[model samples]
Target: MKQRSSPSAMTDFYSAAALVTGGGTGIGRATSLALVREGVRSITISYATSAAEAERTAKELDSLGATVLVVRADVRSTGDITAMFDLAANKFGRLDILINNAGTTRYVDLKDLDGLTDEIWDLTLDTNLRGLFKCCRAAALMLKKSGGAIVNVASIAGLRGVGSSIAYSVSKAGVIQLTRVLAVALAPEVRVNCVVPGMVLTNWIERGGGGISTEEEAFRVAAATPLERVALAEDVADVILGLVRSKLVTGEEIVIDGGKGLTY
Candidate 1:
């Protein structure tokens, strides 16, 4: 059942459960909190290295009278992805939503062909594209059981060839196409959709040293956006939450870039 209304207005997720990848920070963190606030029955947040942040988020969700499970896993590894889903299924019994939000990138200049080496390409493709495919495959059966939904966090870069690096942009393009394919692959039982966020304010850019000139690049993008503002993680999260609950939505890639994509 999809809540076609405001996220805060919907409170019918009493028996629903969710698994959020990269749930320690940014859009993932915001989505996890939104799920809990919407009265989801259980939530399992998977983090790659942000153990402390995950623990802290878990504590906050737990304090809100929500069941929270934090798992350490990397999407790049199939074994870790399997284990993460296993833990969620074991703890929550069934999953109603899967948020594939974990991703990785580097800050190599687009013109530096040498910088886009095999290692860099593999790192970006493995984590952002292949890893996400594996996660969706692993969760397919479980989600089928509950007629669950999937919301993948992609980027506006997937739509345009502008992002951190050439490899990163290419991988996200794959993510967009992957979402479309999986939606058809898992139809009638589960829904698959993606969110393409533009220039959101998050530490991911700083951590990855994305090809941006400064952390304030988001504000610059915002200034050019028709909305006259950059996106926040919560803004992306809100759209994701809606996608997760939408009964009629599948294979849809909604851009949450606040019209930034139009200019670029």
Candidate 2:
């Protein structure tokens, strides 16, 4: 009798090397750790301004017996992106996973069109959308060689059209579409997918200038959420890991909002 092999048996990470952008903190940090736990032995994590945190995460990965490379690369800068990918290629000789998790947003009130200034809009679009595209382009050739996977971290705001600001929502929406396009563009060699998380309880809010300001406000959001809670960074990381390991799935967006979008 012939038996089917397990998906885990088919997609082994023990020999895989991965790169995670924004891998210093929040969801990026969580995803990097998850990959190490899944037996990925070599990983490169890139950070724009989270050098201290990136160092901390590198130490953690080292402690887990994974060879870790930490690079300071701002995705907005083409030179930085190119240098980061070049370093990863030099160190690992191959890359099997790419996680596009670096992004930025500002907390402008939805109706405050004037508050969504050009600077804020430009920064959000450049970092979240344009920068993500550049990372994909730089990794495309290596990913093709390794038959790798890409998991982009987007937001449910893109689908629901509500988030920190108009620019942020729009940028994430771009991420979703970009994932779909890249899935086809990289087909038969690489798979690309996206995870759309909602109301994740991370420092992102504080760092984004505090849209969900208070603990009480956060609790209210959890109460309003259909699942009676908000997502943790680890929750989103799990989804991203799943997408990375899915051998046959691509061009898909998995929403991880604890069913929050159902109400909307």
Candidate 3:
């Protein structure tokens, strides 16, 4: 193979400032680590309330010689999201990437209107759909000036009907639509995309979410997927990192569902 030019060699080094929401655990945590390995200088990890885990992650990244800021910002709040990104811009001097990964979920039986409750439905939509809106609005402002990349952590639930809960499925479906809309709206200035993952082996799932259970049956149901197994956080994170650099990839949904969305 012939030697590559200096420009190609500097691609990884060029990743200076990046921000990832929900970075306290799972896919967010994996992506945060991956960014550091790719030479991202400073990163802001945003979480709703997981302060201890966030601080621990910050310390770990700092120990690796990377500047990691653990910021407490609920994606559901427009004010909080906007302020957090503003703080990130000031801290790093330049914003290069944004990963909209923070989300909320619950399980519900749509048939039982009384049991589902209006509050539950609203909360689900608020965080998964409205929260994404708030973060994208703020991130858009930063990326327009600097020309950055955004990867929304959507889920297979968004693409199909299976998920932790009924409200979760609906909220995620909205997220998929939001991703496409923003990808077009942001256009040439900022590259926006989304990732849809299937049964990822995360703490949230193993511990049982609202509508989903951590039973042998659930695992069997997921394992029966096309890939015959589930995915790890790192597996999905690798895909997110690749999508972040593509100048041509926008208004696209990259499915990382272990072929679960595909034929058996």
Candidate 4:
């Protein structure tokens, strides 16, 4: 017997019901918008800053008549992440995709590890590494029950020893490891993969590496990439979509690095 479809489910028959963390701006924002364009009717964007930016994304997506929710969240907190899952699943009925995109970066001077203190390490790991694990743990359970996809936002630093800073690089490397483990553990029910970006012009750069440097210097380093340019958020978005929908692929890191790795 053919399964009967309801009016509500029918609206999203070809659409994904998804959750995107750190969706207020930059790569997360671009990915959320792209997901909408790809026919996801129900989307919840979680962020930690700039409620206005989140609202702007919601408003823009609303024009498509898609259901959009912008929630303030700290991925580092289990309570917040858990609540988001509950709310998203409750609203959408089921979650088909989870994009783990929330993270922070810093320039680490190993020689000053003493000065760095435990607070700095905890803060960085809490958000980038530990938070990602918690989210996947929560999302994996939800996705396992229904069979879905997870796209973890990592960095090229995970693949190579190079990145904006040692901490950022190491955190992202942990993300890739987490993705691999989850991919195997999730099995046939839920697929897990990663996307790694290189030299993207986002707020993190301005705040961490490029914050004190001149814009031209930033451009010079970015242009040193093989593609002679840095990645755009949208560039990362397209690759994410491909990974999310591809059932045959899991436990891989798609690099949106403008072929920067090839330059060597």
Q: What TM-score should be assigned to candidate 3?
A: 0.89
After aligning candidate 1 to the native by TM-score, how far in Å is the CA of 28 from where it should be? 0.6
lDDT of each: 0.86, 0.91, 0.80, 0.81
Query: Tens digit of lDDT per residue, candidate 2, span 158-258?
Result: 99868989999999999999999999999878889999998888877666654547465669888988879888889999999888878778999999977
User: Could you say which candidate leads in TM-score?
Assistant: 2
Cα deviation in Å at residue 177, candidate 4? 0.7
Over 4 Å off, model 2: 1-11, 208-214
In each prediction, how many residue pairs overlap at the backbone (N, C-alpha, C within less than 3 A)? 1, 0, 1, 0
lDDT of 1 by residue, 1-264 (tens): 974432222225878888999997888889898888888859999989889999988988898788988999989999998998998889888888899999888888789889889999998999999999999999998888888889998998888868889999998889889999999998777889999998888886666554555447866777788999888899998999889778788999999878876765
234, model 2: CA deviation in Å?
Answer: 0.4
TM-score of 1: 0.92
Off by more than 4 A, model 4: 1-13, 209-218
Identify the candidate with maximal lDDT: 2
Pairs with steric clashes in candidate 1: 2-245
TM-scores, in order shown?
A: 0.92, 0.93, 0.89, 0.89
In candidate 3, what are the lDDT values of residues 1-264, reduced to their tens digit? 994222311145345688999997889999998888877878999998888888888887787778877889977777888789889988887777888889877655546546766888888888888988888787776676667788998888887867767788888888888888898898767778899987777777755545455455447756667767778899999999988878677878888877776764
